[model samples]
Target: MESARIPFTERYHATQHGGIARAANSSVTCKTAAGRTATPCAAVQQGGAGANGHYRMAYIDVDSDARTANSSSATLRIPAGSRVSYARLYWGGSLRGSGQKAAKDNGRVLLAEPGGRYRQVRADTMTGHRPHSATEGFQASAEVTELVRNSGGGAYTVAQINMATGHSTAGVWGGWTLVAAYENKKQPLRRIALWDGFQSLGADRRELSVRLPGLRIPANSHGLAGVVAYDGDRGHGNDTLTVRAGQHRAHTVRDTANPANDVMNSTVTDLGRPTMRWPAYRNTLGFDSDVFDITPALRSGGDRLTFRFTTTRNPGYLLGALFVQTDTRR
Candidate 1:
């Protein structure tokens, strides 16, 4: 398939506007836990989607430890019948935060087959590609290194999957960052139906009953509680980001920074553990006037919460965030 010649601005707008449709269609074959060739129940999109199909940026927490904390690879699902003709993975290692700008790199895409696992498709490839900027969107016209270097952190990779054909594929390609191409047609704002949807958690042998108050904001609101999980790399302290809501004080929390567990009491040195649970219960919940006017408040949707994590650390640390929305419609 010919490369999609999308304008840099157009791609940027599309990526931020359209969130991911579906990462992988169900027809793709994958090795199940039992070691049988099986189809994934659903196409898993690690990071949250942006406005359109564009995905929210994820990171690789290379904070203190560099060896074990560094990420190796990530996975992207493809439908059973859809043919993945072309694929690419974008990465950047720049510094641009508070007022910092690091260097950039030109990353490459490596192919992986079923049963083979996500081994490096190539070893001689150079790591100096500019990741597609929020403006560049899905097309590989941008470099991957800039995204990371610009973020004021270590190196980072942005994954994208190219699906010109919407059909399912045989075996899903691993390490392909499937980014949002473009809509078959322009979607109007009025056509947007902001409603609560159901997310099925089929794994872990557990079920959660989610509650959505509504889409409207209530006059008087109380405390808030949410869940934060990590992917990619080693150690628990990797997941760290600053969260701000209008005049409310911005707070920074690491995946292992939960007050529930006493750091002094725990003997485990590593913070980011699979079974590490953060105590997440609040007493009284109230929403101040400043809370209603912040970016977090405006973007308050039932299933939409800003989650920042490293995809480079473990290649799977696609952070997940869920916020409760109370509709004032009643």
Candidate 2:
């Protein structure tokens, strides 16, 4: 039987190698010299080296507990006037637990958002990690435009990344500002999930919503919040998304909507970084792909809202947070 494809928001299950590499959201790959790191120079070329010589490049993966490693602090240059919007962390790890509680401690890996400089993004404390009751598991972290942290351990190949200027949904009028080292590899893309009741404006039974896939937003720095709804196993609804803006009380819950729904504990700081727990189990927490309604006290086109709409969802689950925007810059 064909497995049912849930909402447009979905998590990826990358196959593992061994030891720490087996953990969820963990991955590793080999690249050329110029392609050795996150932001590769577009002018530079990669060829002459033998199989052994081409095996030097490594992209490290790190999560909450492992963000302080030496590998996470690599440096690079971001064109002086480059305006960074979003940063994504590609995680590769093992998911071999059963039932909801089995993967509770090791659910998802969360990377920290960029502060003044680009730092790694982590999962919410309550949702990211589930206890490692299972056997061998690993976790890895990827950097965005080289500004974010790149912890060593579970380095995976960079599937696709375009850091051109301006948020061009058209993809026709911009230069490749930052290119992934593993652009050639078949890396899993990020997934966007949505929910009702969590926003302030309330769900729109009529209009559909959508946004750019893998786009970055500041951690708690006031941007658009996207949402999606499965609506009881009826496939997907309109791609349209409705974002609600305002001061709404936010809380975390598990994938399933049961009393035992897994809860994620998180808090956004002034610096806009959220320290969250990695979810060990698998649920659709960050698996929606469309709109995010508010918790009942706000509206959509108001002051608390920022961010413009993008077009599609790449593939896997993306770990990050959303905030109310005081201004408009999308």
Candidate 3:
């Protein structure tokens, strides 16, 4: 289900990851790379190389404490003196290894603020889900406005995400996203919106578009756009995310980390650079949480902004969310 819009006056930021490769049987074994060691998921790309000269990629729990269930951390950067308007936590992955009753428990997760301990958080509304299959799967989310408001920006950890450990043909993948909108009087007036759902882009649907209407934009305006999707293979062509302001020409969104032709290529970054997160991965295997600046496209302003996501390939992709913050007239 789609979420209700915020006031449309806030700016936002986020943090996320592609899950870690489980090295052993225990969920604890997968967390050796947390906190202290800047272990890039690249180091453990495969269980070990084989005669075929190929490596297998998988996922594991990345929580800091093995004694606990599951967890992973990411840095949420917010400017000082800004108040958090709204914050939402999103977690999803392949359900095969996510264990029993994943659908029932998908609504609840444990979250720890910077310099804090874990606490229960529940989804206030909808969850996008699908049974374990050859394609990517479900996503669950909860509002964390108060938790993050007080915690402020830093390293925030999420536990009990219900993502599976190990690998498969579909791939063992999972991750978390914390989207926070803030009120910074010091910043420019902008239209910030977050649109989300669990939808496929293979056989069933080839494209999905999210529209934001009744907007005031300035000429040569600048802004940012981002998406959270799954099951996209790196180097896959014909997958693109395009944005257009009203009747203006549509511009394909891309960055150094994401190519113009392959927006779903699995990776996590801020405008193309790697972000700080445990089990940090340069290649998310089949998961993606990427952002792109849409400045050039907004040069000719209009009243409505439409974002079109298209993926023309096999095995498909699952979309979780899309966030946009564009410059606007006061």
Q: Which candidate ranks first by TM-score, i.e. highest?
A: 3
Candidate 1 local lDDT, 183-210, one digit each (tens)? 2223211111111111112122122222
Q: Which regions of candidate 1 fall more than 4 Å away from where they truly are?
A: 1-11, 14-18, 21-176, 181-232, 236-238, 245-330
Kindly list the per-residue Cα lDDT of model 2 for residues 34-105, writing each as its tens digit: 234322211111211111112222323333334322112112222332232333343322233121223332
The TM-score values for the models, in the order shown, are: 0.24, 0.23, 0.81
* Clashes per candidate, residues 3 or more apart or on different chains: 79, 86, 1
Candidates' C-alpha lDDT: 0.21, 0.22, 0.65
Weakest 10 consecutive residues of candidate 2 by summed lDDT: 168-177
Candidate 2 ranges with C-alpha deviation above 4 Å: 1-81, 85-94, 97-127, 131-242, 246-320, 323-326
Worst 10 residues of 1 by lDDT: 282-291
Residue 1 local lDDT, model 1: 17
Sort all candidates by TM-score, best to worst. Answer: 3, 1, 2
